[model samples]
Target: MSLYKTEAIVLKYYELKEADKIIVLYTRQHGKVQAVANGARKTKSRLAGSVELFTYSDFLLYQGKSLSTISQTEIINSFASLRDDLFKMAYASYVVEVVNEFTVDEEKNEPLFALLLATLYMLDRGEELELATRFFELRLLNLLGYRPQLDACVDCDLDLAKIDKVKFSSKLGGVVCADCALEDQYAMRINKGTVATMERLLEIDYKKLDRLKVPESTRQQLAKILPNYLQSIIEKKLKSLDFLKTLTMTN
Candidate 1:
């Protein structure tokens, strides 16, 4: 029965009854929260626009025994441009969906929230969407304590520079050189440039992601492969990720 205020990003929502809506939000202080917004489905509801997916809002919430209730919400930034374009919206949805998948209730995840906000801002401003998405994925993995190794071989500790075809092993959490990968059945072929691109992405800031120059083939490869790698670790396919692919196909 205590009321609290916080800045939050609406991840997803669903209609609950004729007038109420259930909102899933990732807050700055509170990791991920599920709350019911009474009357939010009505045409004139004060929470209508503010509760939309991917919108950043300042919310006044009341704690309940089961789920919290959002008493009021004010839009801080609608990120209106993200909604205006399909590419932006699709990528933004991917980011939100991944966040929703990785997190649980009432945990303070400041780093992840900041990364998502920065990523959404980059997507909204019309940056290179592909690069932004990949970068977001890498950074998100790092924040979640599952950072993949890119420096050297996990087995012999050999530098990967001299290798031609690097072996990326999900079991080992990164690239293992050709020699080391020989013994491991779980390793897969990873291009040198792709490995380099992944390393750069891990270190670069969101503001400079557009300046990166990765080839289309490399980008496509990473885009296809990285998610599968992540899925191995995360143990589930994100629904929004599938929707994003479908949106791209139909467009």
Candidate 2:
């Protein structure tokens, strides 16, 4: 079998027979990979620490007939601070869940991979979780080709400056003018500030995310609308999301 090395982030890990683990990882070169790590679950194993969740590692793999084996794993970064607090851990988990659900193996999603790593690093360092989440949502949509229409109305092509109410249409993949919105009944009305917030999110980097002070009302609106829009596009429910929400409420 062929052997290779790559930089990877542990997305999740599950116990196998007794002392082995099935690890799902996102790699910089190979995209996502599912590999078996023998003896990774045993205490005092050399691979045990490197295979922990949210850790980034350099891995040596042997390509097997049924599944790849993790021959070796060297820890690159552990984000150990994340394990100290529940909020940070939960936020990081949410990010990982989204990455795991949305990405596929060997797809070469460099941007998405970078985004996840950056966000997780930030969360581990105790950045504002809400801002990080919003940044993640906007960037994720952009990556998936569901970039929202924020510049102008979908139909009338108005500058949006003249429009006070922006109607978002999942069908049209963006906002539409009141008159233009008649074409799609599923559209929801949003204020001009919310529209502007969406635009800023698209243009700005995650580091500058906190500068945009979105009101609770606008945040609530986006919290509802963006997820609904994603669900419509993704066409499936994510169970990890439910767990994330529960953790958010209790934490």
Candidate 3:
């Protein structure tokens, strides 16, 4: 067994037994890691706060045969503000859930780690939650190599600006001209405004996302399309997304 230290964000956790919990973290160096936090369930346990969802911390982990164990941890940013509000918590949950679903264990992705950290910080700081989430989703898709073609048709290679109405093929992984889209029966009609919005979301830096404004119609279009595209890629709906929709409807 070997011991190492790294920075990580707590994605999710599950009770292991009576007092221990299995923490799923997206570490800066280690990617996704599942570590046991002994006595974490007990009141006054030092690991309890550090292991909470969306907490970013530095950890000393002992690598073992089956799972690693957290030996020591220091809180980096608890993102406490996220937990204090229901809306923030729900959006934050969707962010972490996307990370958890897309990533695999022990696969290091520094860009993805940075994106997640930046996104959480933005959400916690009271940025526009829907816009931030959409930005994160677009960026995440890019990082995962599922970036959709916005500049041109995926099938005909025609410039999208020249086309009036376009369709997005989740299977083809980009936009297709109306003529080309006919070949792909699964392609869904996408508005030019929505495509522009998606492109802008992908291009803008996360720090600048606060200044970005998305119209309600565009936001609604994206809200319907992005999740379906993601589900097509991931092969299942995210539980957090369903909960998020419910929360949005109620509020």
lDDT of 2 by residue, 1-251 (tens): 99999989988999999999999999988888999989988888899888888999899999888678999888889887766777787778777877787777778788888888888877876867866777787889999888987888877788788777788887777888888899989888888888888878778877776577878888767766776677677677755567667876675
lDDT of 1 by residue, 1-251 (tens): 99999999999898899899999999999889999999998899888899988999999999999899999888999988887888898899888988888899899989999999999988888878878889989998888888888878877778887666787877677888878887778687778788889989999877777788999778867877677678778788877778787876686
Leading candidate by lDDT: 3
Candidate whose TM-score is highest: 3
User: Relative to the true structure, how large is the alpha-carbon lDDT of every model?
Assistant: 0.86, 0.82, 0.91
lDDT of 3: 0.91
Task: Give the higher-lDDT candidate: 2 or 3.
Answer: 3
Candidate 3, residues 1-251: lDDT per residue as tens digits?
99999999999999988999999999999899999999999999999999999999999999999899999999999999988999999999999998999999999999999999999988998878888889889999999999988889998899988987889888788899988888878888889989988999888978788777778988887887788788889898898898899998897
Give the lowest summed-lDDT range of ten residues in model 1: 220-229
User: How would the candidate models be sorted by TM-score, starting from the highest?
Assistant: 3, 1, 2
TM-score of each: 0.92, 0.88, 0.95
Output the TM-score of candidate 3.
Answer: 0.95
